[model samples]
Target chain A: MNLVLLPEQTDSTIWQINDARQVSHLKQHLDVKIGDQIKVGVLNQARYLAEVVEIQSNQMIVTPVEQQAIPNKLPVTLILALPRPKVLRRLIMDSVTLGVEKIVLLHSYRVDKSYWQTPFLEQLDHYIQLGLEQAGDVIAPSILLEKRFKPFVEDRLSVWNHSQTTFVAHPYTTDVMPINFNQQCQLMIGPEGGFIPYEIDLLKENGCHIHHVGNRILRTETAVSNILGRLFCA
Target chain B: MNLVLLPEQTDSTIWQINDARQVSHLKQHLDVKIGDQIKVGVLNQARYLAEVVEIQSNQMIVTPVEQQAIPNKLPVTLILALPRPKVLRRLIMDSVTLGVEKIVLLHSYRVDKSYWQTPFLEQLDHYIQLGLEQAGDVIAPSILLEKRFKPFVEDRLSVWNHSQTTFVAHPYTTDVMPINFNQQCQLMIGPEGGFIPYEIDLLKENGCHIHHVGNRILRTETAVSNILGRLFCA
Candidate 1:
């Protein structure tokens, strides 16, 4: 953990950190002691160099200093077809660190029924927190699950107007990946076997541009990072 | 395995498949039968759709057909600090699937000495084959291991002259990533903890341009894929 995140505080003068994992990271990685300044950020708030006031195995108390600068978030939403359980945690963490403003996990025809049953789906907040700590940022991206694909696309997608560019990445398309893309966009990535023909049609009809990265096929995780790299300055 | 790769053949019409993993993937995933056409590629050669002549639990016989198109390789070499053993296989596989022309696994100050001793290094060809199969390509990129960091940076890096952009990804740099980089180049990525000051100086003296992706600190794997995605069309 690069930065320790504290819960919403009632008293701004001092803060108590009770999360065991954060405490351990402070104790083990940072080698904390009284008077040592640790990098810290309040939940959805500014970052600070917090001075350690008290230290223990289970908890830590610190006084936060002046607010420090934080990195900017990418102006995008990742509309991902819910991946398998084995691929969930790391993908979420990577997406969070890459600084997506939001993520919507949607269902598709190629996604197996058993994949939605994984217990890991409930730990989205934890993965977001891990990603935030890794990125040394305080604001967590909102994650929304759209179990029904067609209805969500028809109804909720209108929330993003023409000003926003929505894209669906496909392997069969002759269209090329967008270069040096910096504008607001929503990128939809398919599941393992890929989105069915009908699903691609639905997205295309909804004004989503269909593009392929290159001739070679990349795995879901690799494709996400690669696309994000070009989509923003990441 | 998306495509079946065959060993270099002595006879053009008939070929033997002896690899057990390939056999299992063909039986379970593709479910091949006699007279069935399967996508196949010869090592470092052209791709083709071959007809299955015979099938068995341990072996398969196929007849090669007309050449098919393959994806293009990235116009650069990946000069990476040898990562931990756990990260080596997948990174190599990802690099191959991303279509790099060459890879140089170099040693650096922060790289643990024990990492170089991994037996997994011997299975580089296995990872390359898996990558080629996933991308449906036949050519394998050459991998060179440099145990002496100073000598390699001072002596070998000049193989890429001023005409070819050579970069060092350093987090401390204010320089931004190069965009729409289509020409030949070499990118150097550091180890987990990052390269030391002395090593950075040595690299600077060798004409490596220092640059950073963004503010967020990403894992070595994520950083590599992110950089490649921007460096080329991958």
Candidate 2:
């Protein structure tokens, strides 16, 4: 909430920007004023210090200076089973903040049918923007959806076949947790109840090694974050 | 809820023990009968299929059939800033279920003073049991408390200064997201408002490399889970 985001910067030397929402937010909420400097992150650009150039009726103009590069992202790509719409929204933002390069949301047997119809799918940009605004990063990860699991596994998995490692996280099964992984990898996580035995078998048959994060059953969102943290820290 | 944990067996044919609390939980909550078959994990022993042998008014007896090894835990150790009591309780349970070998709850600037007086610390064993029951693991992770950040960083941190990589996750840094981590590692996470610059500087000086998940700010719990997942996957 401390960082301000602008949609587009005006080219005029004395850039005049209308910020009704921000004005109400700043004057009434944050109690900001004309000469104060605020952190601003431009869409797809580095963050910068912005001086409040002018304040008018529901509008505020800011002058940007000294651009700073946003931090780099994690190298891995994450492919997750689509969770409930409510959970999916939070997960999308979480993943973005964690620096995942790409995300693929696939359907699974345990996924609720109603979740696929969520209006959030239509406004993917909004979700990504929320993440960018929070972390002050301008780059958005690529997001894709797979309505069916089998075909995607059969057709698209080949791309990951040559990958140094591919891990499929499940609650059961005994596979050594990976350590010090220095190569490009792909991680596949299942739905809430986890991948059905058949799904697990199929993934195992396809070269994805089954790994467990311990014995505790984690909710979809918790599992995603836990797996990511472990993978990167290693 | 699915798997029940039993104390170490004594002699060749009998399980040593009286756990009044567990006995009561099984009777009142799970509605266990004299002959119900239950999944049981021995402390440090493999999970075994056990059949109820006897049920007394205040005691239950079971015999093991087959031994099964529990899955491996996450490869990294988590050093978290103590969150509020409720969140801390949840974190303790979650960390256990997720299979972390150790958890260090330390003091940070943002940690509320009232949190230090929580009853959760007095009942740590109860939280550990909940995690073990869920994950079916017998060994509990070692828990430690550090009241002052500087002293601990200067004195005790050397023990964690092994070959394993150490990372301090911060939101504003420009460093590339970590990837393909090594086998053993240490991760430091900040509190809600995050680590102040001085604290971050102190940690950096103490041999921790600063890193970021991405651009979105995540709650402490979410950050822990995400980093664990990424580290395991990597």
The numbered model that scores best in TM-score is 1
Q: Candidate 2 lDDT, tens digit per residue, B36-115?
A: 76777776666776777888877777777777667577677788888988788778887877788888899988888788
lDDT of 1 by residue, A162-190 (tens): 56878788999988879778888898899
User: Chain A TM-score, candidate 1?
Assistant: 0.95
Chain A in model 2: its TM-score? 0.87
Interface RMSD of each: 1.7, 4.4
Looking at model 2, residue A128 earns an lDDT score of 71
Candidates, DockQ: 0.66, 0.34
Model 2 CAPRI rating: acceptable
lDDT of 1 by residue, B36-78 (tens): 9898899987899998999987999888877799889998899
Q: Residue A218 in model 2: shift from native, Å? A: 5.3
* RMSD from true fold, candidate 1: 2.1
